[model samples]
Target: MTSLPESPRPAPTRAAGAFEVRLSDSPLPEPDRRALIASPRFGTVFTDHMARCTWTAGGGWSDRRIEKYGPLNLNPAAAVLHYGQEIFEGLKAYRHADGSVWTFRPEANAARFARSAHRLALPQLSAEDFLGSIEALVRVDAAWVPSGEETSLYLRPFMYASEDFLGVRATQQAEYLVIASPVGPYFAGGVKPVSIWVAQDYHRSGAGGTGAAKCGGNYAASLLPQQEAQSKGCDQVCFLDASTNSLLEELGGMNVFIVGADGSVATPELSGTILEGVTRSSILRLLADSGHDVQERPIALAELRAGLADGSVTEVFACGTAAVITPIGRLAGADFDLAVADGAAGRVTTGLREALTDIQYGRAADPHGWMHRLL
Candidate 1:
């Protein structure tokens, strides 16, 4: 696994903008807004406000603001549209049962966001600054936070090159913005096993590519394969290492994990070509805490199939910020089909899911201090 270096402690907190709060006049209707917040779907409905900060090579970062959520009048020649210089992060603010809102390991997400920015050649935001931006916005939209089961205010922090140039290079001018959506469950129904299409023709990232970064291009490249998976009646697609095409890499939007018949857990190690999902890392820690001998190493495709055949692999699941944990029922390729046991959530899989959700919903003890109260 890829171990993160010692994280530098952030300085004292400060007001995000430090200047006068420039409020937006364009706000949503109160009653309609309440209905939307009551059952907001994933990424479909958004909060009324957003946080944005501008960056320039010469002027550094501008004072940020909680602006009205609206369309961006981007230049037709924006570099993000041409050069594809963009990166983003996905996290959530949960309303605990005690009526206080909190988030899990937001610092980890903030750190990963910086790493992703560095990889994309974009300016990095300080951990404190990043957290402050989100917190500031969440505080403003505190009433928009949903209290339904498995519901959260999904925060999407994105940076994109806003320079109005068509040159095929990273731009010096960029804009970072955080938009929030009150989202319900990722899957429409309750948690269920999903079939995955094993993609062999197209790869999400190759050797020495920008795979680790949660950039827009990587997801754009997977659209075709993802559509193909949908056509095949699969819920998602799994990608293997681009070089060897044998070792399991990750799914389209989540990381994969396998449980052994002997009750051990295993997941593909970070090979610099797969996203380091926050949910995936947390699950590893949770599994170990539950006394499962977790292994993070290269898991060969052939070995997984063989293990499944011999009943050694008990369960398979995929995890990410969107879907906390989704069990895999089968893997469909062009020729052969690999089916997991009965297309059901395994004992270990469901147990970990419940445990993580418990912490998220404020039902379980947070021994690791992962929950940071926002309200």
Candidate 2:
């Protein structure tokens, strides 16, 4: 018997130009805003406005607008308050040397946001709306986009269950918002290698869980282990698979990669427990384009240990939205400690970081068309 053909994907809904603009009346003065942008913390300083929209089971998405940035009012019994039904996406808007603003692969972030909403029982927002919201906020607060070296406006788009019921069922109402913050380098010391603590006691995700989704609960669960890593004098924490605890999973907030001396690069495969990061995929593409043997497969902890001991694993690094790429300097556990090749940033790691950042800040050509112009 012949099998039926797969269904065609639905066309993305277009909601651009739907957000109504309501500029803030008491915006910060130019000098103050400039001072804040000069040396801004990662997520602390915010722009003057934010974009918002509401979703309902009956009415669907409505009331899209750009409003003043401030605290949100939620019911005490909101589903997200107790059930943790929420999702978020992070990306950046860069100011090119020619004074144009752009973002890197926002469509990828929008697709992932939809997948996360499906996983968390929240409403799936359209790609047009997602991009529209970001553009709306950035257009009103264009000055917030920093022009310094390695500085950009960090955009955070998030959705949450706004329904007041607490019956543990899917939310009937939801709210989506986009906020912007000017940020400098993710790491304060500027691209230095970092130490990691291998988490022997805690696991990030299991066989069937929300590990693949970008939600608040997953991050909430990692706080204790991260604190433990800090106590051990490490900058980050590495988690192993939950089933056997022998395979490498990921770091606390980023994906990990191992580079071999033989010009092979490998990272943990997407096993339904690892968050598919946009930066991670970009680096993988860069690696493949440069003719490196890129492998996405199960990386056994024992194998990594053996490779490091024998000098087969020449470099290690982590990638995420916040920290674009960070070299793994040392790996420490309860029983063992291993430094990655004299504890300095490796050649491959630095090269990939600069290559990717070049494409981001428009220093080099974007051959893959990953950069999206926002303004």
Candidate 3:
């Protein structure tokens, strides 16, 4: 199987050009919109508009538009339907007390989106273009940005092969889109320590596979394992490295972290087999800033299990866009269950979560300028 070289990309511009904006003729009634935002669910409900851009072999990326949110008209034999050439990203739009909307590390998301596109043989949406598309969509649906507590507008940017074909090859046509949902919290009970299930029977992705890419195929492969994890009463599944199945790679959708009694923190290093999480990177910086030794190295499952038995590792947690920081209260498998810090959210976990959320919600000073103002 041959791979397509990345097409020469155009210089990215801010989302300030004369972009087309077509408002919905029949948007959701204000009464319903207000009620919906009061207690919004995750990912199911969408805002009034979406941003779209198309890419073609000869034309590059063009035809950008912000139109009403609705179902797409995909061909019966679309390449994405068969070949699974697709990638996506997840981030949030936070509403501050001063009525400004901001997002954390959008440029990081854009850069990672481009990396995922490259790995999947799809056209790279410029960082400017990605940020601009997000800005455009959020601008039209500004009212949909939820407030109070940890509520925010969840943004999902995705791209997939749109060409109609039966045989497997590089994508000739693709579509990039941005849609948003008002969400309250990822874990229904909010940020707390949760249990983790160790997947001993399956591996997420192998060496030189799409494990590191934020693509649907990698997630699709983990569904069965995730089902198993849930059946075992675990909130999420922990996957080991595919090559050895001993070193900790990451949680199904989030990154894993461990803290030691020596006031040190560490997470699984990027081994080309795990998705590089934006939140995970931020936590490392914050940990170092808070006078904790931060380590980014391969973590062995045996060491983690032993650390729990001993007192080397005092806390364990998971980090991602949806669930900012969830402490792993328990690590359970078929044969054994290890209690983590008396099955409670630890000090390190809570402090890190607070620091990150503070920067996100404009409660604290953003020294890194990570928040990009969408409105």
Query: For residues 135-231, could you state the per-residue lDDT of candidate 1 as single tens digits?
Result: 8888778788888877899999999999999877778899999999999889887688889998888899987899999998999888999999999
Better of 1 and 2 by lDDT: 2
Per-residue lDDT of model 2, residues 1-375, tens digit only: 122342332222245468898989999999999999998889999999999999999999999999999999998999999999999999999888777778999999999999999999888998989988987778788889998888999999999999999797999999999999999989889788999999989998888999999999888878899999999999999999999998999998999999998989999999999999999999999999999999999999989888888999989999998999999999888987888983476889999999999999988999999998776
RMSD in angstroms between candidate 2 and the native structure over all alpha carbons: 7.9
Candidate 3 per-residue lDDT, tens place, 1-375, comes to 122342332332356343478889989999999999998878878999999999999999888888999999999999999889999999999888777778899999999999999999999999888889988788789899988788899999999999998888898999999999999889888777888999988888889999889999888888898999999998889998877878998888999999998878889989888999999889988988889989999999999999999988899999999989888899998788998973475888888888999899988999988998877
Candidates, ranked, TM-score: 2, 3, 1
How accurate locally, in lDDT, is each candidate? 0.86, 0.90, 0.88
Pick the winner on lDDT between candidates 2 and 3. 2
* TM-scores for all predictions: 0.94, 0.95, 0.95
- Model 1 segments beyond 4 Å from truth? 1-20
Q: How accurate is candidate 3 locally (lDDT)?
A: 0.88
Q: Kindly report which residue stretches of model 2 are placed more than 4 angstroms away from their true locations once superposed.
A: 1-14
> Which pairs of residues collide in model 3?
none
Greater-TM-score candidate between 1 and 2? 2
Residue 43, candidate 2: Cα error in Å is 0.7
